[model samples]
Target: MQFTLDDEPRFPRGKRSGIGIIGCGHIVQTAHLPAYEKYGLNIVGVYDISEQAMRTVQQRFHVRHAFASVDDLFASSDIEVVDIATHPAERAGLILKALQAGKHVLSQKPFALDMHTAQELIQEAERRHLTLAVNQNGRWAPPWRITTQLVQQGAIGEVLAVTHLFDTRFEWVTGTVFDTIPHWAIYDYGLHWIDSIHCWLADTPLTSIRAREYRTPDQPMESKADWGMWCEFVYANGAHAMIRSVGCSQTQRDGHPFWLHGTQGIIRGSILGKGNDFVELERDGISSRYPLKGQWFPDGFAGTMGELLCAIEEDREPYHSARHTLRSLQMTLAACQSAEHNGEVVPYEEMKR
Candidate 1:
C-alpha cells in the first residue's frame, strides 16, 4: 500500500470568517496576521489595550478599522470570530466577552493557567453555541502533522512511546514579556509539546505525569534563564512519553528531534529550524524518508485558525476545539504541579481537585 496522508493545513471551503484581532502584540504582527493574509482570511479590524500597539498593527497591515476598546470591536456585526492573542492571564475575560457578543473565538495557547478557568470558557462557548478553539499551532507543524497522520492511519500501529528532545539558545525570552511568566518553561513554551502529545494519543487516557525544571550551573546569572525541563506522561494503555527541553545551549548544533515507537514500526523526525526537517518511517525492515515543505512559523498559525473556520462553515466541532484542548491543559498544569513538589508524580485527575 502506498503511504499518503493529508498533512497540509486546511481552511473553510464554503465561507471564510471575518476575524477581529484583540491583541496586536509581537505574535499578531509576526505570525497571526501574516498567516491570515497568506490564506486570504478576512480582517475585520483590531483592538488592543495599548492604542499605539493597535495603531501600529492597523497601519502596517493596512487593516481598515482600529477599535478604541474591546467593546468597540465586539459591537461590529461584521466579525464572526475574534482572535484573543493576549497573555493567558487576561485572555479568559476577553473570551467570555466575545462569546457573550455572539462571536466565536480563537484563543492563544496554554489556554488558561488553571483548570477551572479553562473549563469555564469552554462551557460558556458551549452555552452560546459558539466555537472556541486554541491556537495550539504546533500540531500543524509539518513534521508533527505528518507523523500524527501516520499514527492515525495505523502506519505506526499502537504507539508504545514518544519522545521529544530540543536544545536551543534561550535568549529570545531573556528580556521579553515571556520571561515574566510563572513556570515560564511549561506554561508558555512547553504547552506546544504537551498539546502535540495529546493530539497523537487522543484515544489513550493519561494516568499521571512527572516533570522537573532546572537551572544550569554554567548558565550566567545575568541571563536569568530556566535552563532545562523534563516531563514524562503515563497512559492507561501502557504507553508513555518523555520530553526534555534544553533552553541554554551555546553550541552551534541546536536541534529539536522527536521519536515515536510502536508495536509495528518507528517514526522519527527533527522539528523545524534545524538544518534537516523531515519524517522517517521504518517498518518491515524498510525505511523511507519524507521531506517536509513548510516552516512552523506562519503555517502552524494558519492551521489553527483554518480548522476553526472550517468547523463553523461545516457546523461541526473544530479539531482544535477548546474542550479537546482541556486535556492538554490538564497535563500541562499537572506538570507544573509536579515540578513544584520536587518532581513528584501528579495524577492527571488531580488537576480537577
Candidate 2:
C-alpha cells in the first residue's frame, strides 16, 4: 500500500499545549517523548525523582525545564497535561495528584495495582470532570486493528473461542537483575496482553475468570514468581476467551500472542515481533498479511496523543478512556485472585468488592 504523511491526521497548529512528562524511564525514553515531539505538543517540563535521570532525558530530548518532583511539575504554570509514565505502584498516586491539580492525565497500563484503586481513580476523575485516559496503545497497533476490523466485518463469521499464549523466559525476581520493580511477570508484561485482548474485543467485561500460577526456584523475592497463568473469560455475549501466560516457557515470544477461532474462520496476531509478524487472518482457503504502516514508537504515540487531544477539544472520551481501560485492569486483578485461589472461578463483581 502507498504510505503518505498526509494520510495521517494533523493536530490543530499553534495551540502550544504544554505536557508535563513524569517518570524518566524506559517508556518515557522510547514512547512518550518521541510521541509528544511528533504531535508538536509543547513539553513545557519534565520530572523524575532522580536528578541524573531527569538530566539525561532533558539533554536527550532538548526539553527546556526538568523538575525535581511531581509536585513541582504539577505546580508549573506552563504544563496543561500530565503524562504519568511511572511504575504501576506509583501510578495511581501521581495520577490522582495531577487530576487534583486540574490537569488532564494519560498514564501507563495496569493503571493501578488492584481493582479498588482503579475504581477510586475512575471515580475521582469523573467527580472532577477531568479527561483521564490510560496508555493502552496496543489497540491502535496495526495488526490488532486489522484483526478487529475483519472480525467485526464478519470475515470471521460468529466467533467461537479465543486463545492467547504469552510466553517469556525473562526471570523477574525481586532483589535480582530483573527485580528493579516490586511485582514481576503478570503485572509488568502480562498486563499489556490482557489489556489488548479486552480492547480488541470491544472492552468486554469478563463475567468470570479462573486462573493458576507457579513459581521458580531461582526467583529470590517472596512475592515474585515464575508464573504460569491461565484465565478463562466468559463475556456477556457468551463468547469464551482463554488467556495463558507461561514464564517458564523455553521460547521468548511476545505481544498479544493470540488466536481467535470463529465459526467460519480464524484470526491470529502477536504484538512482540517484526514486520508481518502479527498478521494471521484466514478463512476457508484465503489468507493475507496486514502490514504495519508508518514508524513504530513515535507514530503509535502520536496517534494516541492526537486522539486524546481531539477528545479533550470535543469534550468527548478518548478511544481508550479510563472507564474502558478499567475493565482490563479488573480482568488482570481477577485473574490474579483466581490463581491465588487454585483456579477457582472468580466473578468480576465479586473481585470488585
Could you tell me which residue pairs clash in candidate 2? 255-271, 255-272, 256-271
TM-score of each: 0.96, 0.85
* Per-residue accuracy of model 1 over 1-353 as CA lDDT, tens digit each: 36776657898777678899999999999999998888888999999989899999989988989998899999999999999999887988898999999999999987677888888889899999999999999988888988988998898889899999876777777777777776778877888988889888889988899999887666666655476889999999889999998877776767688999999999988885556677899989899887776768888899999999989999999988999888888888899899898799898668666
Off by over 4 Å in 1: none
For all the candidates, what are their Cα RMSDs to the real structure? Answer: 1.4, 3.8
In lDDT terms, how accurate is model 1?
0.87
- lDDT, each prediction: 0.87, 0.72
Q: What stretches of model 2 exceed 4 Å from their correct place?
A: 1-16, 172-183, 203-205, 216-224, 236-238, 249-256, 274-276, 294-298
Give Cα distance to truth, residue 289, candidate 2, Å.
Answer: 1.6
